[model samples]
Target: MEDVISLSVGEPDFHTPWHIREAGIESLEKGRTRYTPNRGFIQLRQEVSSFLSRHYGVEYEPESQVLITVGGSEAIDLCVRSLITPGDEVLIPEPSFVCYVPIAQMAGGVPVTIETGPENGFKLTAKELEAHITERTKLLIMPYPNNPTGAVMEREELLKIARVVEKHNLLVLSDEIYAALTYTQEGHICFSSLPGMMERTIVVNGFSKAHSMTGWRLGYAAGPREIISLMVKLHQFAIMSAPTTSQYAAIEALKNGDDDMAYMRGQYDMRRRLIVDGLNEIGLKCFEPKGAFYVFPSVKSTGLTSDEFCERLIYSKQVAVVPGSAFGPCGEGFVRISYCYSVKHITEALSRIRAFLEEL
Candidate 1:
């Protein structure tokens, strides 16, 4: 624990920018700590609307379409709870963020995993999606700029999925929480930008990953007024409001933090290449990740299960990475290594990993 080079964290290592922090501080200094509206402050919601439109060309009415919540996790929970009915089936693609299955189960919906492997760069295919649809299928969690695996979908690929969603009348919870950290050449594509997707997709985004506001716990859901209204009710009864200071901070992030996001993104891109190449050179057989801050490297050649590899590495070499199996069964032969750390930190971890592999 004392000397571990841990790469298991899934957040930005950067400090929240001073300007953003100042906004929150200024709000407190102005005595702005009262409970915001159930759907969050109107100004913040407007900023979210403007931010989404400016970046992704996805428009939503600030007053009716956006509902702020306590991080993307809460937004995701609201989407599943509000939309899912008992005995309904929710289609999820894995290895994904860990909450989808449990959230669906809590709503008395069946959680079905659509396995996505490295064969197709981990992007979900139309064939894979269509095959999983059932009469009971009601929602699909479209998590791109994905966590754990760092996969993202291009516009064409998202269009393929849009067609499937339309044919099946499936609603989608498109989690774009990692939207800004994408390494794709075309940048992040919002799922709602696809034809007919705006009506069917609930876009969940937040400030944690891109803005380094993990502690601030601010996120918002942008979608149809019908759904946002329902989610607001749940939020009102349960959460009352997101943190007031964080909401103020996020307004600043959405309004003037593009340069900050761009700077952080460039740093992440460099670290991404560093870890992916290092893992491949060490014979871990990692594929290049196109989004997020993590790399999924296959440890199959080491003749160890994902857990065994992770445990042995941590115990013997003092290097920590999450076993891919923690994400899903399809992730069994791999491990997730994060590159949110500095270059020297990553370099040391790679060296330790190389030594660990040689010992194996």
Candidate 2:
């Protein structure tokens, strides 16, 4: 019996780089474990501010506009909780990360899901944005370089969406956790960097995807002072602060982890191409992904639901991939395959999938 080939993980398979790890170790060695501030260490916030401004031209004040959180997850929770009131509608693009809708519901907001499809590279178009907005709509959860589909919105596309946002006066929580992993020559554009967008967009990013720092439990949100201040107060009451040693390590990651990011992104890109081509050759009809580490391939040709396909594949071939239905109802005909694993592992998984398809 062969071991299972698991590709459902959303994290980078790479370990946290050495320098960042050493920084965390040194912080602990020096007894830097005490709580810093409810907003997190001042220096780490400063680094977060600098990193965003330097790389994406989106500026936020270290003192007031940046609030560190346990992870991007908590930042999402904080944003939703701070802004949502009962009966307020939150627009969430479907086939997104699982947390957005649930968090909005838990915060007393109504979640309105807008379905995106492969016809548009799974991107949320301005038309889709316009169609979903009601007078009650208060927030738009934008998860680009999207999770299940690996979709990325370019600057021109975002400009159109921004126009809709401006027209509707909607606040956006842009989850840019996978920002550094974009494959386009133009790279990832920070949503807040667009003219007239800074005031309405809360950008949530973290060290997890880019630095392979998933265990570090560090992320930050940058936005207008008013929104950020409220988020900070909520964070202070609910969680107090993010971890101290992780903050120390994240400073090093922000300053010195570029080369490591490039290396891991390059590897993911290779596996992405491999799995995409292999899937298409096996008649799965995969779209080429432009960002993130996932390939969402249509398994409709097999005449099975996403959940059924996933179950059968894992049982018969000992390979694991997430059903797209696990993301949302619109994802029912697809399966999400992660390229975060090594080429050899991806190759083996593809081989197993091919055999499974033949058997079906």
Candidate 3:
């Protein structure tokens, strides 16, 4: 096990950039440790507003539309708690992150999974969205640049889904935590920025993925003023404020972390290409992912279930990748390999996988 090559986690291998870390340290040195606003510092919120506006063309009023949470996880929990009523159905696209469905359930809302297939690059299609909508449907969990599958929704695709959402008057929780890691030529498309979507969409994002600041535990949710107001109230009563030091550090991230983002995304892009090609050559059919740091390859060719394949691979080759069934039932025939490690690390893992496949 000491020689195991683990590719199961979806965090960057890079350290937080010096400037961002320095900002956190500076806050400590200057004694800026007291709890700030329940919605977080006004300056950090303003920076988030400006960053989104400049990069994605989505303008939010920092004072009214933004509410900072502990992380994207809390933002999701807060939005679901604030908006959902018992028995309300939340449309969650399958083969996505694991949290959305359970969080919806904890809010006493019904979780309805809409299975997304690799045929459409694993994206949640307009047809799929429309098919899932019913009289009880209240919200859609749009986790793009998606986890496990690394699926990203294109602009035209978003427009198509947005039309369905508008028709049903469904609210959307667009989790774009991996928005900055997209490897597409046109870059990541912000879901809420779609026409007629912003007003009905809650955009949840944070510094963890983009800034490699996972331990800092900071994220923000932005949406219509009325909804955000309720979310802020929930935050005030439940968790008081986001960490004061992290909020100050996030200001630095939103303001000056562009170059760091490019550098990390570039590295992930290389590893993405390497793993996709390696898996395909080794007989697993991999759909080319346009975003995020994962490559999901079908294990059906090996005549093994997703769990069986992962277990055998780990035990035999000392290489670990997640069984995609962990994401959703629709993911049962696939395995998710994260490309967040170095090129050398990924190369060794690929070689081991190839050898394992040959031995089969």
How far residue 19's Cα lies from its native spot in candidate 3, in Å, is 0.5
Counting clashing residue pairs in each candidate, in order, gives: 0, 0, 0
TM-score of each: 0.99, 0.99, 0.98
Which pairs of residues have clashing backbones in candidate 2?
Answer: none
All predictions: root-mean-square deviation over Cα? Answer: 0.7, 0.9, 0.9
What lDDT tens digits, residue by residue, belong to model 1 across residues 1-360? 789888999878899999999999999999999998889999999999999999999999999999999999999999999998899999999998889999999999999999999998888999999998989999999999887899999999889989999998999999999999888789999999988999989999999999999999989999999999999999999999999999999989989999999999999999988888888898989889999999999999999999999999999999999999999899999999889999999999999999999988
Q: What does candidate 2's lDDT look like per residue over 132-167, in tens digits? A: 899999999999989989999999999999999998
Residues 228-305, model 3: lDDT tens digits? 999988899999999998988899988999999999988888888888998888788999999989999999999999
Residue 117 of model 1: what lDDT?
Answer: 95
Each model's C-alpha lDDT? Answer: 0.93, 0.93, 0.92
- Give the clash count for model 2: 0
305 in model 3: Cα distance from truth in Å?
1.0
Candidate 1 regions with alpha-carbon error over 4 angstroms: none
Residue 148 local lDDT, model 3: 83
| Residue 9 in model 1: lDDT | 90
The worst-scoring run of ten residues by lDDT in candidate 2 lies at 1-10
